[model samples]
Target chain A: MSFHLGGDKRASLAEAAARVGDGALVALGGGLCARLPMALVREMVRQGRRDLHLVGSAHSIDVDLLIAAGAVGVCEESYVGFEQDLGLAPAFRRAARDGSVEVRESCCATVLAQLRAAEAGVPFLPVRGIKGTDVEGLHPEYARMTCPFTGEELVVVPPLRPDVALLHAPLGDAHGNLHLDQPFVLDERFAHASVAVVATVDRIVPTAELVGAGVVVPGHLVAAVAEVPYGAHPSSCYPGYAYDRPHLAAYLAAATAGGTALDEYLARYVHVDEDTYAKDVDPERLAAWSGSTRAWQELFR
Target chain B: MSWALDAGHAAQRSWTLDEAFVVALARTIRDTEAVFHGFASPCAQVAMHVAKRTHAPDCLLIEGATYAVDPVPVFVPPTGNDLALHRDAVYRMRFEEFFDAACRGAVDRMFLSGGQIDGYGSTNVTAIGGMPHPKIKLGGGGGGGNISASIGALTVWTSRHRAGRTLVADLDFLTDLGHRTREGSRAELGYTGGGPQWLVTELGAFDFDGDGHARLRALWPDVDVDDVAAATGFELRVALDGADGLLDPPSPAELAAVRAVDPLGVRRSEFAEVELARTPGLSGVAR
Candidate 1:
């Protein structure tokens, strides 16, 4: 691989954040409480980046936190609610309620279909489910096509190519060979779907350590790899840590209470780097992080 | 004794609305059949697990978020994607792979809930008000559109079956394409699966009639037929004459199994917190 395309892609979280420009469309990896780049997002908030576009990143705290920090302009969402217990995400709710964030609603399936189209280097892809749905009528960007042979109606979704992908992996080499601990079916597709992929990993191991069968995001696809251990805190990272329930609960509370409470949350936790934040927070709670639900595994066994 | 079978003979009258609804949904699970549950489906997860433990012991499970069927954990993580479900996963596949399987005719059943479902069974999870931008934006379909088109039997469940917000006369936007404008729409799309087979709500159970409209098939106890009709925004097609076709409450065996799977009671969270407080020493008999 040429040095320009695939060389030492190692950098600090701030450097990785710098690579993303204003109004760049970004793909978020491992959404819904797993492997979100929390530190990179926090660093982006610190850097005061604006007008960033988020795609396929809805329905999780990852996007909620960024939107709360006022870093997003446009968002293409499949789903955008918090868990049933957590109610709606506060920032996202306020943003959507006020129409500040230019919101485009796509089904969860459509996002994957769009990403798959991008991965395959196709201009547009036809989906069987889009017809006769509100998702069809709302977006003029989506058009209906009659199958030439069958004369069947189908929705044609245009290709979605993100400028960058914000991803978190369990381990990676200094050369940027990222290995995700879970199945993570969408990571590779998102990486190929984007012009650049930046990842925050828990550990940077030798190239040899990333061997064997697993979900591997190869060095060539990754533009930068920053070591932000526990980067996925408040969200689970396999074999590294589980989701911080208390932290998540705190965030939910703050988000629910809104106003100065949210600002305080940003100041207390997000404003600080991982180290000082970790020091301020309880280590015992952080220790709750683990690879899998061992309790569930043992129960089934 | 394990809650799995320690359950005693509790009369059907003792069942909560949610419990009765779950049992009603579970009865549809045929033995030795593959059923797929999608995102934000905690109630259906509990129902599927109960179905496996009771009547449909051999019924297979394929969860959308975790992609694990018959998850060992009785409790679904509040996060729609429960990692516990990933333990000993049978066949983990993405939504795209599953939808592709449906396109090729693989998935037999799917359970989905939405913000709004119309009389025709077309689900609208895309927008609450008129399109372009909705008054209330909802979580969009993960793959419900393809699943409803492909899955032979799509069981649509909702906790609160209110009018306007839920059981609408017509959808503002269509999230899952159930039966197009007319009956032949699926055929036009080359979809093989029967669209939106069953609809489960708080008050009653429903299915599409020969005319491709939501026909109330059964009602839970204490639910008035007229009340259900009034709750539905559209004119509903009442299939059953009376309590004649109404399903009995879940058996003590099924209830026990449901309890074992949902020890935390996440499924009944739609009710206020006061619902959790018992009258006096019922330990945990109430939903």
Candidate 2:
């Protein structure tokens, strides 16, 4: 993995999004509507990035928006749907059905194993169960080999090294050291496996303050960092805010309708700068997320 | 265990299909088992909670999206990964840790559902047609393929069975392995878990036969073998007990526990509008 040692690694939102080149394999760092890098995602849409391949475990609107914007050509995620809140992701469903996007379906454990292999600098990793299903047949690269000690057959998956890892955390330093809260699904592993890591955080605290938050990702592992408050708006960044269900519902309605409805939505939201978008999302509503548990529960209602 | 019928009618209470469905699912888990259900599964989530509250208090209840262990939520939220589910959790399980534990066969039971479930218990959540290109793209099955083989037993459930599209003869693709496929049996393939131990649907509950095919074992209120045959794509085989398989709805205790855990009735979202409207408590429940 590549690293940027020592010096300040802060960059603007545009610059951070630009680091992810066209067609780069990006490992998005979040699982299902939490701590997703939405500010950077909007920035990439505004910049008109194209033909990107996204890989992740469980996801929702983040990947769906990119596919809706025609930025993604290959989707290797295990699950990409709104769990319980809604149903299937609208744009992703349409893209896959139309054969516009290549869906290289992989499971959560397999994806984790591949990333672990890359982090360990191993060629492949053996998984316990995945052999006796049709999912295994989709990936021709998966090889079956007998264990050396016990004659048991195992499925060996090749290492997955993403070109970039896009993440959004709660705290970070100018030197790019990240402090993510708990339930940081695979971001640390993503940092270790990817060639470069790009992140957006809610606050840029002092290095000491970041260390206190728990520096899960060291400065040396990161290529760039951007301070974008409410960077994960419409998706919760724990202890900061809760996901905006109304906003997400509006987004789904527009995406499901397609045509000019979706076009108008993109123009109104995705095309704008972070500051403008933030203003559009009423501050009072966001404040409610930071209140007691009752307020947090009210957001879903 | 035979539930006392007098206790049910004492409160002059009625039950919905979803509540009964949850009870049927909860019955699959033993008190000693560690059960897991994935994200977007409110029915299974409520079922696990009911089981823990009623018969299986010692059972380890794991949250799907958040991986919280033995969580004591105030109420089941519509979303899976929120702090609502993680409240008062005994321990938070890491993403990889759950998979590793299941692989080692530490996890006893897991609830799985598919876009299409075949007679052999193989499921398809990947696509509708074929791979690479498909007529319809369902949300991919998250770790179901790997964990289905690793866990102790699988409780397969589906709400869309009445539509005649869910229980199919052949799947477009097999996302999780069942008892046996065209290639061979799961034992021959070295899978640790007992494939599909039970299949619970809106119409009835099914148990695997000697040959590992889904055989209808129990029918819900007013559901007969003909009704199940009409909905299922494959040939329906009834249990040898026949009419005796017609089972009672969930008892008053089970229904009360189900409503307590799911105050907002998040499990109702899993069923169709018609199904909800047909049931007394389901459609009129206050949000």
Q: What is the C-alpha lDDT profile of model 2 across B1-287, one tens digit per residue?
A: 22233443545236767887788888888999999998889999999989998889999887887888888877787877777777677688888888899888999999989999999788888888868777778889888878988899898989889999999998889898788877788878888788788898988888888888999987765466788899999768888343232234566788889988888889999999867754433222333
TM-score of chain A of each: 0.91, 0.97
Instruction: Give model 2's docking category.
Output: medium
Interface residue Cα RMSD of candidate 2 after superposition: 1.4
Query: What does fnat come to for each candidate?
Result: 0.43, 0.70
Q: What are the per-residue Cα lDDT tens digits for candidate 1 across B40-109?
A: 6678877888787888888777765666555576356666664655656655665456657765567777
Give the per-residue lDDT digits (tens) of candidate 2, residues A48-74: 999999988989989999999999989
> What residue pairs clash in candidate 2, if any at all?
none
lDDT of 1 by residue, A1-301 (tens): 1212757999999899899998889888886777778888888888998988888833578888888888999877676666665666667767776788877766666777788888887888887676655566556888878879887767889888888888899888887888885447467778878888899998888777776534378888888999987887777775655566667878988886889999999999988888887677653344432323445333222
Model 2's DockQ score: 0.65
Error at A266, model 1, angstroms: 1.4
